[model samples]
Target chain A: MRTLKFLLQKEFKQIFRSKSIIFSIVFAPIIQLILMPLAANYEVKNIYVAFVDHDHSSYSQKLINRVYSSIYFKAAPYSASYDDAMHLIEQNKADIIVEIPQGFEDNLVRESHDKLYLAVNAINGTKAGVGSGYLGSIIRDFNQDIQLQWKQPGHFAEAQTIDVVTNNWYNPYMSYFLFMVPGLMVSLLTGIGAFSASLNIVREKEIGTIEQINVTPIRKYHFLLGKLIPYWCLGMIVFTIGMLVSRLIYGIVPVGSIPLLYGFLAVYLLTLLGAGLLISTYSDTQQQAVSVAFFFVLIFNFISGIFTPIDSMPEWAKVLAYISPISHFAQVMRMVVLKGSGWSDVLPHLGAVFALGVVLNTWAVLNYRKTT
Target chain B: MAAITLDNIVKTYGEKDQKVLAVDQASFAVEEGEMFGLIGPDGAGKTTIFRILTTLLLPDSGTASVAGYDTAADYTQIRNCVGYMPGRFSLYQDLTVEENLKFFATIFNTTIEENYHLIKDIYVQIEPFKDRRAGKLSGGMKQKLALCCALIHKPTVLFLDEPTTGVDVVSRVEFWDMLKRLKAQGITILVSTPYMDEAVLCDRIALIQSGKILSVDTPANTVKKYPTKLYAAKASDMHQLLKDIRSYPGVASCFTFGESLHFTFRQDDAQNIAGLKATLDSGNYLDLVINEIQPNIEDYFIQISEPVHA
Candidate 1:
């Protein structure tokens, strides 16, 4: 135990001596938290609307005015033909095209029905998908307005109609950044901590200092503890700073218990740091360790429900996602912080994370060798 | 009792056909508190034997022990009793000298003050620079700090592999002097070096080459094992002189050492200096000079390492 203390002292001195690591630990999350949510947003806005309105009627003009006045779209040059509007889309001048057929205001007036065509450029898939949905909702709202205008005096008694409204329960405003900042913050903390911890051990190998340590009387567990505990503490500190940034800068204070958030973060770092140690034990050079760690961290991020909703994933991939510690931690972070979930809500996730810690940490300890 | 022992130890690396015999069926022992040296050139497997005894590597076959503990079974006990300074100066570079020393001391469950007497002579030189980072220290100081850290635990046996290989000659002398003092304090020292001159400093030395032991004895006895009378001969045209000397007959070995060629005679060759010189004279060797000289450990090392002699 005393030997481990000395080893930790040595490790911490080295970690603190490096200015680059210090900046990364203190500021990388701060930077990422402020930038990532703004960049990763999927909400489509300010879509360029190009239209070929052949109806030349008051109704067509009113529909065009409604499209321009909505919050989600902007009016671009009117194209005389569908091909010209497509050309505008190809030139990146427009995002969606509205086509009203030559009806002379006859179909909706006489038959109470009309057809409209929409062409959306889908080069950027996510942008295209969300933009089309906005256009669809805008047309639906316009149709309801026209129906209310027509239902004025003695026409029809209370027609059967169903009204639907989307409340977006967790994020009432549908703010993407508020929904994403907590998860991104979690990823950033784990990323920097795991990377620095593994690189530290492999750096010692490259410098040949490990040979001196290997010849000593120190036990393997003692050495591993000495190497991992410092980074674990560093991860928690970084996580705390990230939380402060989310709350202060983005106005994203968690509704759940902050202590519960930290409680799971402490256990999550065990799994992360343990995996990092395993990488260090297997790698002979710092470069190899970094590349391997980068690969695993990327994979963990992709499957962790940080960016995509895990419910939408395929069945097999969902199973694989649940197996990742990041998935469990990210879920708990969202649950506790965003949802104000209690102990009962996160108990299962916490148990799984602890189990991953035990398994990965035990594997790391067993793989470590004082002698080959 | 021997502080360390290796009985017919063998170590190999790689596959069967391309296998390298790093230490091949070699055996030797170092007496308690004796300053033992494994002397050879680069790639001579000096480091391999040190690694085996340090318990950092296991021999492919045969048995070895340190402090009466088996390297295989009692490795933990051996680790507790031994201190190893590997060939490279493998101390933490970013750490201050004092911190490096203190860390190693603590790991061994002791303090530097406990064994200050053993390393006081060496550590005091670098005391003023204790706050300096080890990587920024000079080669000599780096060696001293490494030595101080290795000895902080006061182990029963100390294994130093090429501790002075890259050190300056003056500092190399000081390091060996420190080793002598450590021996006096009853700490058995096993040091290996590629530098042949360092061999004579050991109380007993093993001359090894290409994964095999050539000779094991006191430095004087190893020198005595040189088979024939040797001569130091040089002339104005040394290049031409070598060709003429080799052809003039009774040369068992002729190796260049500084300005002269060390000439040794074959077992059956007559050791008549006048006759040897008369032949060289007839061969038009200019300003030829030949005289008998005592053989040193380097001469014995070369003699034994030569395939013809082995």
Candidate 2:
């Protein structure tokens, strides 16, 4: 116990003395919270639009005005030719192009309907889909107005249609910040837990201080535990700061008990710190440890449902997410903050993280040797 | 009583086909409270043996004990009773001098104040900069700080593995003086160094090479064991003189030492020196001078390490 205390004190002194830890703990969370939401929004607004209106009658002009007035589209007037519209789209100056034939007004008045072509760029598949939906809604509304002006108002009332209402349960507005802040918190904690903790041990190895400790009477387990606990505490402190920033900056607060959120975070931090210990045990140099930790954190963040919904991923990918502690923790974070979940709601996730933490920490302790 | 004992210790690294016998089947013992030295060049397995005794590494096959505790089973007890300063300066660089000292003391379930006298003479010199980080300190200061940390617990035995390998001459001298003081306190000390001059400081020394103990005895006795007459000869052209002496009929071993060539003959024939001089004279060697000198530990090591003839 005394040896453990000494080791812990030494570790704390080393971490606290460096200004880099202060920067990572305080400033990194702020930067991630402020910048990530702005950069990751999926809703497309102010899309530049162009058109080839061969029918330059009042009817085509009115239709063009309607598209220009909507918030989602901006009309960029160009030559009334398909080649010009194609050139605009190719240059990335326009997102969508509409082409109306020469006899559109006469055909629409005489035959009651006319075909129009809408060309959309499908590179960003989701944004293109949403844009196409917006254009279809606008054309449908215009056709309804034309019918109401020409025919009886009750003519459309007889037409049957399915009315589906979607009630978004937890984030009604679907704010991207609400979805992102908690996951960013998980990522931030991972950075501190894995990078800092592993660097601590590897630094000792590089500078030859590990040899000094090896010759001491301190037990291997005690030494490792002492090294891990301080970093675990730092991880918790960073998590709290992340939570506070989430509440203050994004108005996103945990709907569950704060203590419950911290409880899971503590377990998650242990799993990460254990991972750092395992890396340090295997690596002989600081650079190697950093690279290995970076690889794990990168893979974890990508597959852990941090930026994308896990349900949208394929079944095999989802199965892989089950093994990632970050995936489970990120799920718990969203559940507690957005869903008001209780302990029972997170017990399964907590169990997996706990099991992983125990297994990894035990392996780290076993592999850690006093001698080379 | 033996402060340290090893019965046929053997340590090998790597697999059988590419194995390196770091410490071969070697055995020796250091008496209680004696200053014992393991003198050898690099890769001679001096550090390997020190590591095995300190309980940092396990020997593949051996029954060794330090301060009367088995290295394998009683490793914890052995660790508690020994102070080890490894070959490199392994103290925490970011921590302050005082913090490093306090940390090491706390590890042994003791306090710095509890054993202040043990390290006072050494620690007092660096006490002024106790708040400064160890990384910024001079090499000598770092050496003193490491020594203090190792001795903070006042272990029964101290293992210093090449502690003065890279320090300045003044610091090295001071370190040896500090070691002598610790020895007076009845602490059994085991130190390893490649410097043959430091061999004289040990009460007894073991000359090791290629993981094998060549000779173990007092420095005086080891040097006195040189069984042939040694002569230091130099000419105006010393390099040419060395070659000329090697081809002489009765010369047994001829190696250059500093500004002179040290040679021994197969027979201690009085006429051999005159005959060698005549041979050198005929070879156009000028200003030839020869003097009989006593052999040092290095000469003794060279003589033993040489391949023996049947």
DockQ of 2: 0.74
Q: List the residue pairs that clash in candidate 2.
A: none
Point out the worst 10-residue segment of candidate 2 chain B by lDDT. Answer: B301-310
Off by over 4 Å in 1: A151-160, B15-17, B247-250, B267-285, B308-310
**Highest lDDT scorer:** 2
Over B33-58, each residue of candidate 2 has an lDDT whose tens digit, in order, gives 99999999999999999889988789
Residue A251 shift from truth in candidate 1, angstroms: 0.9
Least accurate 10 contiguous residues by lDDT in model 1 chain A: A152-161
Computed on C-alpha atoms, the DockQ of candidate 1 is 0.82
Candidate 2 CAPRI category? medium
**Model 2 misplaced regions, further than 4 Å:** A158-161, B15-17, B308-310
What DockQ, between 0 and 1, does each candidate earn?
0.82, 0.74
Q: How do all models score by TM-score?
A: 0.95, 0.95
